[model samples]
Target: MSSITMVQAVNDALREEMRGDDDVVVLGEDVGINGGVFRCTADLIDEFGEERVIDTPLSESGIIGAAVGMALYGLKPVPEIQFSDFIWPAFDQITSEMAKMRYRSGGQFTCPMVVRTPYGGGIRGGHYHSQSPEAYFTHTPGLVVVIPSDPYDAKGLLKAAIRCEDPVIFLEPKRIYRAPKMDVPDDDDYVVEIGKAAVRREGTDFTITAYGAMVAVALEACEKAAEQGWSGEVVDLRTLLPLDEDAIIQSVTKTGRLVTLQEATKFCGFSSEISAIVAEKAIDVLEAPVKRVSGFDVPFPYTLEHVYMPHADRVLKAIEGVMTY
Candidate 1:
């Protein structure tokens, strides 16, 4: 095992996968020579040369379109979209072409590609660089949405996405990209199964469900709540689409309460879906109404970025409220 940050773990996953598979290639603006904005693809161009580590034009649509073409040609293309906030331009290409290729072709063809992008706030990047738009992709039928909160999951889940037969939206939380280092396994085959929720903390009071950057915030809130004589369980929903409904129901039923957190807009977000699922499956087990701590409905702001985010204080308050309710 080697201690590394989430960024380094991602770099390792890409490097390891590319070394193992001849068909695996990475393409994005600045991903080749510049090694990506976060350096996740750093040194890859030096190792794999220009053909495998490609630098494309500054166009999200073109990047994804080319990746889809490569996927159809039996090449595993991992397309980087720079930032989640900039992924809208490629929405049609992603949700329409890449997502529907297999189903529209009626099982004869498969689009095996991974769309990687840095998402969420905390770098002080205004609206254009920071946004949690996982919901839009998760609503699509053929896409798998994944968000890793730590270095281990970042490496393992990425390797799994690369080997998957379907397209995957791997959203890296830019906020915790570097910090919270861990001793990640150096094995190239390490893979955290997709669609499973990891329980970060165990408690009987209430359950806190979150993913990506919010998982750390959920753990922080659990720590604060612990000091107040309340215990909260933290469940990291690593995969958003094929959600681990069993884990969520089990946690909420054990705790008899639920408090969800998300860095995206509060209204009609992924947290809403989680709350609904809990209500449907574990209604009798819940002691209090589900609570959601999330970002404001307004656009992501520059000056008020911290205010617009859901911090540990916000999550702790929600946890305490649900425990007492």
Candidate 2:
């Protein structure tokens, strides 16, 4: 086992997968010599060569469109959109082309491709750099969305996304890239299955459901709530789409309340889906209305970045609110 940052774990996964498969190719802007804006693809250019690890032009649409073609040709292309906010340009390709190819073609075609982008707030990145766009793709049918909170999940989930037989949107919470570390197995073939949620902490008063950067916030909230005599359960939802509803239902049923949290806009974010699912499946078990504490429904602010991101205080407040009700 070895302690590693989320970014380093991602690099290790790419290196390991490339070493195992000759058809795996990585392409994105500045990912070659610049090593990606977050350095998640660092040193890959040297190890995989320019042909496999490429630096493409700054066109999100073109990059993703070409990746679809590569997938059709049996080449596993991992395309990175510099930021999740920039993924709009490729929405048509992702939602229509990449997502529907296999289904629309009557199973004659498959786009086993991965679209990776860093997302979520913190690090003082303004609106353009900090949006969590997972909800957008999660609502679209035939697309898998994943958001891994820590280094171990980051590495393992990325490898699984690469090897899956369908298109996946991999959202990395850049905010916690280096803020946390964990002893992930050093095996080069580390892989975590998608569509699963990990129980971070177990308690009975209420459940704190979160993912990505907010997982840390939930953990902190649980710690604080513990002092106040509230035993809060924390569930790290590693994958947003193909959600582990069984785990969610079980947790909510056990606790009788849930505080769904995320760092994205509160209007139509991941929290909404979680809240709705609980309402439908665990309605009888809920002691209070599902609570959602998330970013305000406005563009992320330049000067108030910290205020815009969900914090431990906000999570705890919601937890207390649900528990009391």
Candidate 3:
């Protein structure tokens, strides 16, 4: 095991997969020569050469289109979208082509690919660079949405996504990409199962469900709640699609309260989905109304980002509200 940043672990996963599987190829703008805007794919070209590590033009649609073609031809292509805010240009290709190939083709062909993009707010990226768009993809069928909070889950889930037959949208939380370092497993074979939730802390007062960058914030809130004579259980939802419904139900059942956190807007967001699930399946066990601490229903701001995004204080407020109710 080694203590490494999330970005470095991402680089480790990509390199390990590329070395083990000849079909695994990476392509995106600045992914080859520049090693990606965040350097998640840094130094990959030196070991894999130009054929495998390709640098494409500045076109999100083109990059995803080419990846679909490569996947159909039996290559596992991992393409980066530079940022989640820029993925809209390739929305048609991703939802229409890459996502529907398996079912639309009667199971004869499959697009085994992974689209990696940095998402969420924290850095001073304003609106263009700090949008949490996982809900858009999660709403689509036949696509797996993954968001990792730490180096261990980031490396493991990424390796699993590359090997999976379906297309996976791997959203990297840029806020915690380098902030928190953990002892990540050095073994290349270590792969976290997709569609699973990791319980970060065990408590009985209430439950906090979060993913990506919000996991850390949720944990902080849980710790603060503990000081106020309340215990909160925290669950890190590693995958949005194929969500771990059983884990969620189990957590909410034990705590009798639920508070979900997300970087996206509250209306029609992923947090709403979790709230709905708890309402439908575990309503009898709920002690209070399911609460959600999320971003406002407005564009991410440059000056007011700290207020716009959900933080530990906001999450703690929600937890306190649910506990009191």
Ranking by lDDT: 3, 1, 2
What C-alpha lDDT, on a 0 to 100 scale, does residue 27 get in candidate 1? 98
lDDT, candidate 2, 201-252, per-residue tens: 9999999999998898999999999999999999998987888999999999
Tens-place lDDT per residue, model 3, 177-285, is 9978999998979999999999999999999999999998999998899999999999999999989999999999999999999989889999999999888888999
Please report how far candidate 2 places residue 221 from its true position, in Å.
Answer: 0.5
Which is superior by lDDT, 2 or 3?
A: 3
TM-score of 2: 0.98
In model 3, the Cα lDDT at residue 208 comes to 94
lDDT (Cα, tens digit) per residue for candidate 1, span 137-239: 8889999999999999999999999999999999999899999999999987789999899999999899999999999899989999999989889999999
lDDT of each: 0.93, 0.91, 0.95
Evaluated against the true structure, the overall lDDT of model 3 is 0.95
Q: What TM-scores do the predictions have?
A: 0.99, 0.98, 0.99
In candidate 3 the C-alpha lDDT for residue 179 amounts to 74
